[model samples]
Target chain A: MHQKRRKRADERRAEILAAAESVFAERGYRAGSLAAIAEAVGISKQTLLHHFPTKEHLLVAVLERRDLHNLGIVADMGLTIEAMARLVDLNLDWRGLVHSYTVLSAESVAEDHPAHEFFTTRYDRSRHALADSLRAQHGDRLPGGLTPDQAAPLIIAVNDGLQLQWLLNSRDVAIGELFRAFLATVVKGEPPAST
Target chain B: MHQKRRKRADERRAEILAAAESVFAERGYRAGSLAAIAEAVGISKQTLLHHFPTKEHLLVAVLERRDLHNLGIVADMGLTIEAMARLVDLNLDWRGLVHSYTVLSAESVAEDHPAHEFFTTRYDRSRHALADSLRAQHGDRLPGGLTPDQAAPLIIAVNDGLQLQWLLNSRDVAIGELFRAFLATVVKGEPPAST
Candidate 1:
């Protein structure tokens, strides 16, 4: 009976999150209210509070859900440069997911935000994972002095920097092409001497 | 008489914007309120509204002030890849400026945001200027097929992407090194060959 109750509670939480995401995306994070989100989910604000306690809590849950989904994709897949590239491509394909969260995450920088630690830690974990992957694949091919730690940040930085441009004007830019160039640069183990 | 009134009005407007920026930075966009900003400026909400009609207008004014400052920097500078690199370096050096504006800009994506057009146009102008600079510097040096338009977005993307990591874990990452590496790759003008 306890397990069944927990399952139902979890399902309800997921429903709330889905509704919140839609509302947040449409209204932008700041304009979105707990009452509106609860309304969308056909729940009372009191019930929403029972589940999330605060809007920040709900926002963090949404981000966590996304992180879990992305991490799962990376974890379950085979390790290869191609796989890494594909993972990034998947992120690009879900531009809306990236766009919505990025906007919210940026807005989450205040002293009281619940998602602050989550975003900070999320970035750290992503850097470590991507770096670890690079170390594993190209342990033998690093340029004269480059280490996995150095390469990892570069990789992460490029991935992130690309997303900003994608958000601004995905209409004109090919995110995949840029990622491919970055991957090739990494594989070659040196900055290209010339284009 | 007109000049005196306009001068006082501009001074008041600047004062309000300074207060608003502080409040917005402290509280995040959504949570920050016009009343709070007015209080910070030691003015009534009526006075604040007299200077700037709405919260969105005040926010856009703050962003415009920053962009104008940046544009001033860009204008006094000559066209060259080296100048572009220096501009990137300058931006990273004033990392707080980038962090504050980016955090704020992300929150300014609401459908009715007064700053939405400003942010969009600012991005467009920056990309165009950077692309033009690259083309001027390396017109013939680019790999046979790559154009500045193609390369400019990639550079902008990397710069923006690195900001997310920088904002998250400033201690573990050196944004400058990664940017330098990227600039080197761009200056070289060739796509990295596959291993």
Candidate 2:
């Protein structure tokens, strides 16, 4: 009975998070409400509270879910040149998701924000994982004499920086092309190809 | 007499924005209030509203002031290797200002945000100015084979991206060192030296 209840609770939490993501993505964090998220999940406010306790908590849960989703995509692709391609492809594939999360993540930097710790850890892990993969792929042959830690952040930074540009002018700047250029420059030890 | 009144009004507006910057920096956007800002400026709420109209308008004004400040800094430096170095220096010199603006800028990405247009234009102007400077420096050399337009966003992206990382872990990374390395790589048309 306890196991069945646990399974049911986990399922409900997942459902609520999915609903919250939709609401937050559509309405943004400030405008998104717990009541609306509950309604979207077909749950009473009390039930939503049982799962998330507060709007900040719900926001954190939604962000965590997205982070896990991103990590899964990165992990499944495995560490290869193809993995780099896949990373770019995945970001483009989920442009809305990427855009929404980027905006929300930026907002999450406020002191006392529930998602602050989550974002910090997520950044650390993502950077480390990508760096590890790159190290594994090229080993001693990696150009630019970059350690995994330094190179990892550079890759992450490029991804984020390019995303902002893409958001502002999507037609002119292709996120994938930028990412590809970044990868080529790092791997080949060349300046990015002139536009 | 009319000129005196206009100058007085501009001075009062500047005072309010200065106070707003402090309040927002200390308490963040969500917790910051017009009342708090008024108190900080030693003015009544009515007097504050006379100048700012609303808390959101005040926030927008603060952002506009910051954007203008950064633009002025970039412009004063002129476009050359010195300008790039000055950009790095200004970021370090005004680290607090940079942090405050970055945190607020991230929050202002909401679709209907009053500051959205301001940020968009600020970004465009900053990028274009940097690109123009870079073009002048190269004088048709096109070292990386990339146009200034293509390379300018990349440069901005690295700076912004690195800022986020530095904010997350200032102890782990030296912002100035990273930026200097980045500028060296871009300006010298070579990869970063292995260190």
Candidate 3:
């Protein structure tokens, strides 16, 4: 019975987090309210508070949930240009999640924002990981006269900047195709001078 | 004197807009309040409202003020990579404006955000202008087998992505230098295959 209750509690937490993501996506991190999230979860604010003691905690959890999903994808398929492009394809199914990500990342730029550390660490780890993967896949010498280190940030930048553009008009921007094209330019083997 | 009063009013409007930029920078577009902006301007909310009717109108004015500054720069110096790198250097002095711009641009991705249309129009105009400038500067072929039209958005993406990263840790990321490096890769002339 104790194990059964623990499992039920875990399921309930997932339900609340899903609701929180939708609320945060629509209303934005700062503008979104815990009360609304509770309402969405069909629970009292106190019950919601039991799971997430503070709004900041809940915000962190929401970001962690996204990180977990991304980590699983990268881990299962290794970090390839194709994997990153596939991430963009996955992003289309959940525009709200993408919206929250863009908003929170920008919001998190402020030193005092709750999610500030979350994004700072995220960028650092992601860039480092991508750089490692690029080096591993292509050996030390990469294409376009750029090292894996230099190319990593540019690829990450395009990945993010494309989302902002895609959000505005998905019809105009083919996120996956454009990303594939971007990859093509840089992955054409080392430049003539480098060679 | 009516002329003197109008001049004072104009000065006050400028002060309020500057204050708004600072507040919005620190607190973000949606979370920052009109009351806070009025406080920063050393005036009552009523007086603030008298100048700009609503918070949305003030947002428009703030964005317009930024555009005018950017326009002056681009116009004074053509849309060369040097000019853009200079713009990045200029951003260092006004971290607040850069912060607000990043946050608002991300926020504006949401369709109903007050700044949504403003950003949408800005990207379209900026991209078009950039593409035209590139074509005029370089004939049909661009460096990486891309048309000027294709390169335009990529450059803009780098510009924006760099800002987001720079905001997190300005010391580590030399925004201007990084952008200049990106320009070098893209301006190296058409790929070997393209020829």
Q: Best DockQ goes to which candidate?
A: 3
lDDT for residue A61 in candidate 2, whole number 0-100: 76
Q: How do the residues B53-153 of candidate 3 rate in per-residue lDDT, one tens digit apiece? A: 99999999998988889879988998997888888888889888899999989888877888888898888888789889889988664665566766777
* Per-candidate DockQ vs. reference: 0.40, 0.44, 0.46
Worst 10 residues of 2 chain A by lDDT: A140-149
CA error at residue A17 for candidate 3, angstroms = 1.2
| Poorest lDDT segment (10 consecutive residues) of candidate 2 chain B | B139-148
Which lDDT values do the candidates have, in the order given? 0.70, 0.70, 0.82
Report backbone clashes per prediction. Answer: 9, 3, 0
Top model by lDDT, which number? 3
* Per-residue C-alpha lDDT of model 2 across residues B1-195, encoded as one tens digit per residue: 999999999998988888888777555565578899899889999999999888888888887776677668657866665566566666666555666666566545555655667767767876788778778878653464455776677778877787777666666656666665555554455555556
* Interface C-alpha root-mean-square deviation, candidates in order: 4.5, 3.0, 3.4
After superposition on all CA atoms, what RMSD does each candidate show versus the true structure?
Answer: 4.2, 3.4, 3.9
Model 1 bad stretches (over 4 Å): A1-7, A27-31, A92-95, A140-147, A186-195, B1-6, B92-96, B109-112, B140-146, B189-195
